[model samples]
Target: MIATTSLQRMIGALAALLAAVGSASAHPHVFAEARLDVVLSADHQSVKALRHLWRFDELFSSTVLMQFDKNSDLKLDDAELKDVADTIFSSLAEYDYFQLVTVDGKDVHMNAPSQVMTNFDNDQLIVLFESEPATPIKLAGTIDFGVYDPTFYTAIDFTEDANMAVEGLPSTCTRKVIRPDPDTAIAQNQKTLTDAFFNDPTGTDMSKIFATKLELTCKP
Candidate 1:
């Protein structure tokens, strides 16, 4: 359950903070758009890797690009790019890279990243990385795959269904989107919380109530 707790903790604090503000439009200080590709191993029996593309908001991108551009070249050369890529990827290691995979309701651990790259487009920071599950499992029955920031510090959004794709999977397998909705009772209660509630950081994971999840189901 450590993994589950990690997933819930990512956004729990952020959700409480947002609820205290009492406005939906006030949230998501950091904005990011992402696309994920699920790569399958040869023979199509297990998940081999995950390829990710994350485009950060302009404000954050500016900060990162400025820091990543070494030698004051105003351009990220090969060495500079790799430096930034490794830095970002390494930093995210503590958060499990916000990627979660489960088979039979159990979490799967991902090994160290094999590839990391970065680019800048229209003043936005774009990152690409690839990783594999520590223990690959057979591809059949039900599989749960989702990407989330657990911490609300950065809001990861997939603007369209097409943003996520599966590669090397049989046509019989299908994927679906699972958008989480806040519990009505919990939503109502948040409105009446006292200042003390916000001060006390201990509480349930309200973020999962609003976090989005991606589910992939396969035919047996």
Candidate 2:
């Protein structure tokens, strides 16, 4: 009877040990989705222009800033600015990530609007633009953003020399086990993992992730 009792105790101890170990290796799940809207002007000039407004809401375990800094220190010379602008404009024109198309036989171009301060006096940059002259402009597309959570593993190790004497344990049971719960670890480390993920890849691909809608304007 004593032998059976000892075996049951051992089994229970082993189960507990395994459970503790397993708890330290779990991961969190995450996802994201977004919406966009584009509007065009009524004036149907050959070079018609309209406004493109993008509204994005992130659905995830945490909130992430889309713009890293309002005042970027990366200074650009005129050439550099032109290059950047050209690249951005061309990308918007050709890239599938953006919902961009010619409206009223007029080629649409993305333009930087003047900065404006809100009621709170916070300066904000406009990311959308419309072409000049009243042209028959049509709405282009929308973009969706998404990402998955990254996994992290942490282990606690105790050297044999660090082992303290336990009154009841045999010398063979020398190893000290230490670990943290996976959920707790994930909750603690998710921000760091998310930052790294975004840092590596950068912006969402617009073409495959975007859609479009269009309507006509009655006024000039």
Candidate 3:
């Protein structure tokens, strides 16, 4: 079940906090706008790292600020921000930092980030982290990458195509952000999706239908 996932436990707390503030949603209680940097090695032969930036929705941001603003000064000081970052870093590690990467139809293993950074911008809480592939991801064929909460407890969306970019992709490569239709995704996964999951996806993966990923095609 999703509740069993360590990441979900923290999400549940955030959901409860949002609910208390009257801002909770149906499935994804938390929402964030995401940007991804697909970094490739100097030779463009393998992926170097993935850098992510997530700016949370206002309601959830405020809820988080309230919790982390230990001094109750309506400001997240550096220390407080680090506290927030630490909390999130610990929680997200078990979920692969909410990142999924594939190369030529094979899964790419990613190591846990060394640390996460937090920033408060325009009344929203922002999180930044970078993950390195455990093994070299050669640019042999199709490479896909996306960030999302599989349990659907958090809605992480790339607001625009421009938000996804390749830092060092060679001119020979082609990449695009493919947005999937939620309805279509749900329909295609009908057999796998149970009614209980729709009612409460605390244990099931809901990412296939919701993840907007960057698909890269390269001939090497």
Better of 2 and 3 by TM-score: 3
Off by over 4 Å in 2: 1-48, 60-63, 66-99, 103-107, 110-210, 215-220
Q: Quote the lDDT for 93 in model 3.
A: 70
Per-residue CA lDDT of model 1 for 1-220, tens digit only, reads 1232232222222443444445332245667899988888888877888888888888766655566565877777788777767666666777677777778677788887876788888988788888888887677777776666554567778888777777677776777877665576356557544442476544322344455556677776
Q: Which run of 10 residues does model 1 get worst, by summed lDDT? A: 1-10
lDDT (Cα, 0-100) at 202 in candidate 3: 41
* Clashing residue pairs, backbone N/CA/C < 3 A, model 1: 10-150, 10-151, 11-150
As a TM-score, model 3 comes out at 0.85
Query: lDDT per model, in order?
Result: 0.67, 0.27, 0.78
Cα RMSD for candidate 3?
Answer: 4.6
* Model 2 per-residue lDDT at 83: 38
TM-score of each: 0.73, 0.24, 0.85
Candidate 1: stretches off by over 4 Å: 1-27, 183-209
Q: Give the winner by lDDT.
A: 3
Q: Order the candidates by TM-score, highest first — what do you get?
A: 3, 1, 2
**Leading candidate by TM-score:** 3
